[model samples]
Target: MSHWLPASPCTPPGCAVHAGPARRPVPAAALLLAGCALTLAGVLCAPLALSLTGGARRERLVRCWAHAVLRVFGVGVRITGPPAVRGGAAGGRAGTPGVLVVANHVSWLDIPLVAAVCPGRMLAKSDIRRWPVLGPLAALGGTLFVERERLRSLPATVRSLASALHGGARVVVFPEGSTWCGRGPGGRFRPAAFQAAIDAGAAVQPLRIRYLGGPPDHRAPAGAAAFVGDDPLAASLWRVVRAAGLTAEIRVLAPIPAGAVPGRRELARLAQSTVASDSANLPAASVHH
Candidate 1:
């Protein structure tokens, strides 16, 4: 593996444990079909939606589709946060500048979860542009692809992100650089993406994403939803389909003003620590281990 590609010690074998029993094959199969149909609908409609709409209309379209996708997979969503106000007095910076939405990398589901709330340009690894169905959808959504394996491409990527932010675009990024099982230790947030916020004078919106539901304890990670290590996308999809009552809870913490910290490293650390501390404070029964 390349040194630049972020990795986690959490592996498929170690994290496949589920919070609840699997759905019977018949029901799971039906859900799989419905999810596939919904996804295809999104791919076909996305271009037309983008061509005809802008601003809030486009956001609603994306958010509704993402919510439907999560529902089809039997994954519920619960969001808690201060509402984003104009000039971001409540959530972000004190200007009309764009907001940088950053979140923990957990599963492929994380993509839709983020979009369900903050619909905007996403910073994704270049390889996602080649995935079968998701690739087209992501492209249509204005994803900014990055060559994570190439150290030389870092500056260019940062510049592109800054340009987007400068244009008053809310850009979503997963700074872990890779996915991890939603349970154990997650990879630390990489500092590279934070540079764009610094350059654009944007507000940083840190989000904490956790997969909840299992036995009464509800402390275990939803292994079925994790897309980490060598787990294939198809396998992960099936696992999610078969899981019963899985929930993805999103917490949008207060946004840090642009230049709140001196450098990208400090900014990244601030965001990471914020997410970690929030997770630590959740009720022990609801917290993921």
Candidate 2:
């Protein structure tokens, strides 16, 4: 595993190479047009979403908005595995329930793309709830905001998240806590939210998102489309809109059951290992032992 510490954009199988931060040029016209379209689309949909009465209707509208924004942003999504399944890992007489979906975080775009594909409420940092116009829309669309900075609120947050999962909401969380400047895995997964799955007796779905297609300048040590460091949202969004045909490759790994009462640390390690392997950032033989 150490031999492949710096994987190179999956150039060969079983790589764990670091492609490094991306440098892309922002096309002025494309950025302006795409930005305006996305803003207008959000403005048009927010009130309509607010006007809608039912959760199902609102969720559908959000999904539609996700698709439209992808078009406006020139991003395409390709999902690679079966949706998270309930029930025993093998074919059996047991039944399946809602899942606690976990993934590695890379960009702000991760939000809408994940929402579009998963079609469920997502866990966002508390700061997002105060964003200008997007905050209310996200809350209305069923986003569950967690205050990670406060050490005291953790238990309640886990309980709240567990309750949501138990109630059959497919809750998505990025346990890496923050974004990085590589297509490879970032930091380790925090175990707190994994405990929610354990509490809810739900299966843990491990997924990974890899970016594809960027302008020539952006394709450096590897073709990484990361929104990391001090990049402002507008700058990151500008990079996205400027790159036509950019794709977010969402890969779903095999689900890990929360039964047997394995500790949350084990679950987090397993999920992170699975994501690294499936994402081609680590060799399959490199079990997180």
TM-score of each: 0.91, 0.75
User: lDDT (CA) for every model shown?
Assistant: 0.81, 0.65
The local lDDT score (0 to 100) that residue 25 gets in candidate 2 is 52
- How much lDDT does candidate 2 score? 0.65
Candidate 2 off by > 4 Å: 1-61, 86-97, 214-224, 281-289
Which candidate achieves the best TM-score against the true structure?
A: 1
The residue pairs found clashing in candidate 1 are: 19-214
RMSD (CA, Å), candidate 2 to true, equals 7.7
C-alpha positional error of residue 266 in candidate 2 after TM-score superposition, expressed in Å: 0.9
Q: How far off is residue 131 in model 1, in Å?
A: 1.0
Q: Mind giving the per-residue lDDT tens digits that candidate 2 earns over 1-115?
A: 2211222232212222223333245453565577556756676567666676465565566667776666666666777888655332122233444678888877777777776
